[model samples]
Target: MGTATPHGARAHARAQHGTRTPTMPVVPATDWPAPPAGAGPLVWAETVAGGGYAHKVLARGTELRLTDLHGDACAHLVLLAAGRPWERFNAADTVKVQWNAYLRAGHLLLSAQGRVLATLVADTTDGRHDTLCGTSTLVLNTERYGDGATHCATPAGRELLTLAALKNGLDTRDLPPSVSFFQGVHVDANDGTLHFTGSAGPGGSVTLRAEQDLVVLLANVPHPLDPRPSYTSTALEVLAWRAEPTRPGDPLWDATPEGRRAFLNTAELLTCRGQS
Candidate 1:
């Protein structure tokens, strides 16, 4: 008698034979844990496997959080205004405007127009995030690993982001400089060199609140600065829910003079564009 086939093998056989299998939604089942007490209604939830990517156009005020499950995922991020793709996240502006290279709970992600795109509402990584080192490229990963094509075992973060961009009506030229979370780097004060610090272990997370109707692209792949010889990364959990946008009197908006200016500029643009 023939041995029993594994369930996944059976499913693959059916798919190869043209048995229609529709793509599944990102929502979780009823048994999943509910959102925090005042987080508003849950809007999206999904787990991105290593070397994978996710993208969505979220409305203003939605709070999105990324969790480093199993302690090894590097989440590369790119933000763009939903309708105006050219106005996108400016990493240099973000660091220079704030006068800080390390980002945390209160820093605002800004665009070149001086508009606030999102606010870092929570950070549990103890400063394990990066603005200097961007995601991995095909050539870099190809040199490190044997193969770096999208179809290979270890795909480059740039390839993943390119695919995600295409799905959102964008191309390589529209892709902007990205910020990374979970893994980080620090400048050596003595020599002014850079050093890589791996993740902050499991269950660490960072949350951001959207300040505009934004396009968020994320790729979970090994950090380009990672010292590991073999390509490796773990899973990442993403959850977004409805929340209120920042108001003039919000503490975060008034945290600093420069930050307030950015917020005011954001509000001015929103009002002129007929958004409340």
Candidate 2:
């Protein structure tokens, strides 16, 4: 199953909506129970810094937490609805739904259909990160490392798209117009061409609270700042952790005001070294 590029996909979506901006509703971020231990299966694996491969998967009602085991690390992320392939991610909708431009702790990941796909339950940075950019693949041959290298393919932007398409039973021919992490965007000569600026460096982790079944793909490539030929650059390491759904009446399940307070108290106690 080959899919269209992000740019093409967006264009198609626009055509369907008559170029009108999609509507999204703001929702409060309420505390929800975490997932049980080991509920999510590891679909793909990669490490940060070592620069090997990227990770991709389709998750439903899952809580994905990308921890910067080491600070100053940046992970590129892309999300799409499992049910609707053509209806992809809309950053504007997400911002509108959250009632804020920046996503941080206590925000939700909104889908193009005006649904809450995930929630930002907790974040260290208070959600002051970039959402305009997405992730992509890398090819080694076309990079600055020189042609005819030891390996056939290195990391590049387009490869990630191909991998995602393959995993989703789609072909890689029609890649989507993807945003980059920590990449800068600007217009040139009245022509809209989003460019990458630089790396979305260390300790920068983003977590999404899955509202429904969704497929997410991630990669690490050069930023707009690099401006060199594309290549298949791998990550040093990549780790995927799912916060399994907690048991009924679990502290994390508290959604009401009173429940939230109680949950926080319980969480604090659990964090204490000598709590029973």
Q: Considering every candidate listed, which one attains the maximal TM-score?
A: 1
| Cα lDDT computed for each candidate against the true fold | 0.88, 0.46
Over 235-269, each residue of candidate 2 has an lDDT whose tens digit, in order, gives 43333344442323744345434334433443343
Provide the clash count, candidate 1. 0
lDDT of 2 at 109: 54
- Model 1 ranges off by over 4 Å: 1-25, 28-34
Per-residue lDDT of model 1, residues 1-276, tens digit only = 122568767766666563322222254422236555667667777778888888989999999989998899999999999989999999999999999989999999999999999999999999799998889999999899987777788999889888999999999998987899999999999997889988999999999999999999998999999999999889888889889889988999999999999999999999999997
| Candidate number with greatest lDDT | 1
| Segments of candidate 2 deviating more than 4 angstroms | 1-53, 68-73, 96-99, 125-128, 135-154, 172-201, 226-238, 241-276
> What does the lDDT read for residue 191 in candidate 1?
98
